[model samples]
Target: MATPVRVTRLCRLVGRTVSSPSARHRQAVSLPARTCFISTTTWKNLLFKLDERTAHSSLDLFKKDTGVIYRMLGLDPTHVQDNPERFRDWAVVFGNERISSGRHYWEVTIKKSQEFRLGVAEAAMSRDDCVGTNRCSWVFSYAQRKWFAMTNGKTVPVTLVGKPDRVGILLDYEAGLLGLVDIENPRIIHAFKAQFKAPLCPAFGLWDGELLTHSGLEEPEGLK
Candidate 1:
């Protein structure tokens, strides 16, 4: 007979402060009731695709010939002056697979870009909604030479010294833990622990002549 999975729910409190480049300060807020599950079995990476239907402000971005990578031009001053609202912020794309439970991992290759956002969002999130700015999503963004983790419309600075060419994401759904890892050094850059209330989909945000490539799914070194 197979062993049963165990689910654990506890009241969890998490807090952090957000700092802006202009020396602005935001207070730390607390999250509650995080859920976790204990599992001994190894989890494998799941294959994913960029869902065009769920993307926002991405009419101009182009997918490369490989079909696994997407590219977009950097912000243009001339275009911004003519139409400020159209391309003022990041363009977003979401993964097709929605994860409700179990542990999963994936990698993204970001090339020659200074700004980008990578993470997961609720499966039901609106096509027009921006990830990391709402309660249903958790994201890590790099902009202006700084890194930040955003949730519930709040942004918290993530302290890391180096920029990574590739980023790895590990989502322990039942354990309610999200981790962002550096592929080159194999070190965790940041981890967000919270009670995920809904199914999650992989998400990416890009702008400023950035090319974001999805590596599909591959088992990490020892997990296989």
Candidate 2:
């Protein structure tokens, strides 16, 4: 019989910090790239900005204790609700618009938390299915002092020289490409080639008491 996996809510106490360079480096340095074809030139040419208005109303919080009050950044106050029973395993939120074609880009700022998962998911994906576990989602997750791409229940470890404070995502649905970029240096952290069958919504996942803020769209310096 397959080993049973225990599921727990994605909640944690607020105000914890993950800023030790030694810790970040120790976690990310040993992972190997899942995809080996990333090029810096390609990333610069495809730069696109995030559409902040599309930020999701609900996000999964990664806390273990019940009755813990936490803030959901980028969500409207009226839509926020308290649900102690709903926190479990993974917390996810979706971008408002769907990407059916063309190249689009967005950026997210990681302020307080050290670990997170971000990528694109099919609009029809089940709420119960965490991003990167199924064919419908293409996710890049950072946790346990490592970075990796998750898809079809498999992990492709990614290596990076430094931890990124801001992350940029590029979805070239027409070309079947998805990329993760480090916004400060503007370098490609990882990229994937997949056959995306349905319209994709930008997705976010939070665990480990991290705070993520959506930095609205900004035209690439030369694109405007």
Best-performing candidate as measured by lDDT: 1
For model 2, state the Cα shift of residue 141 in Å. 0.4
List the candidates' TM-scores in order.
Answer: 0.65, 0.60
Which lDDT tens digits does candidate 1 get at residues 127-196?
3345676678888888878777777666767887867777788888878888888777676678888998
Q: Write the per-residue lDDT of candidate 2 for residues 1-224, one digit (tens) a residue.
A: 12323223232322222222342342211122223222334443332222222222334333221111134443443454423212122455555455666676777666555667789887656544567766788888777676777776667778876566777787778789888877776666688889988767777666545544443355243320
Q: What is the C-alpha RMSD of each candidate to the true structure, in Å?
A: 12.6, 13.6
Mark the regions of model 1 whose C-alpha exceeds 4 Å error after superposition.
Answer: 1-44, 57-90, 219-224
**lDDT values for all models:** 0.58, 0.55
Query: Which 10 consecutive residues of model 1 have the lowest summed lDDT?
Result: 9-18
